[model samples]
Target: MNERRTPAVAPAALDDIDRALINALQGDFPLAQRPFADVGARLGLAEEEVLARLQRLLDARVLTRFGPMFQIERIGGAFCLAAMSVPDATFDRVAAQVNDFPEVAHNYRRGHALNMWFVLATERPDGIADCARRIETATGLPVFLFPKEREYFVEMKLEA
Candidate 1:
């Protein structure tokens, strides 16, 4: 009964400028008063243009997310990968309830027994378990937490 749902938004077309902007953003973003301007400068675009394009892309769902990735563990925070076996009939409602928790970084749907997967980020190490318990209480489902044993870094960039 696991069914894949199509994305609500249509795919967005990318032009050369959008491609260059995406590539440029993958590098070290400037730490300055006007970071967007700095990025625009590198791409030979005006600051306003850069902002507009970025906004448009986000609104069009071209980019699901745009922000810095933080190592929560470094700052005394914790992250855990969690999964649940959500019934097909109530999957969307369960997803909405899960996402209502600010601690959930993101959620995904997989075609498996543990079909609903998400990451929980908490300010304290113990908060992972607390959040999971709260989610279980809210959704009336069991949550499986997979804490990190070791870490590996992988840097990847793709042509736009």
Candidate 2:
């Protein structure tokens, strides 16, 4: 029998350099095969130490994910943040279907008329529209697309 994997959510409270390191890494990680080597140099720690700390944080579920963010337009891909007015009664079922797509990066239920919102990223630009259509067909609810018209940068820092 296989164990089920559930969402890993942890309360935040990091200590000393661990907290500082997480905040520092909130910015761009080096675009190199040995990223920890570069990061370790800047943080005045050995690469192995940096790797171990990061592994510990991951094990504790303090960091959900860490990696690169690509420019979808430059790559000829498509991405968007979308929402649907899902009825409270069927929200979980509908959300499960939405999350079933590999393209969905994240999904959440928000307190609004359009309750279920999610981020979608597709390999082909044309696929975005078709994906929305397919989701609508499956859920029987219109998905409102919020494609990026302009670029915006939002930074979140994990503090101790």
Best by lDDT: 1
Candidate 1, residue 64: the lDDT equals 59
Model 1 C-alpha lDDT per residue in residues 72-148, reported as the tens digit of each score: 89999999999999998888999888888999966888989999988999999999999999999999999999998
List per-prediction Cα lDDT, in the order shown. Answer: 0.87, 0.79
Estimated TM-score for each candidate: 0.91, 0.75
Q: Give lDDT tens digits, candidate 2, residues 88-158.
A: 88877787888888788667777788887888899898888889999999999999999889888777665
Report the C-alpha displacement of residue 50, candidate 1, in angstroms. Answer: 1.0
User: Worst ten-residue run, lDDT, model 2?
Assistant: 1-10
Cα-based lDDT at residue 151, candidate 2: 88
Q: What lDDT would candidate 1 get against the real structure?
A: 0.87
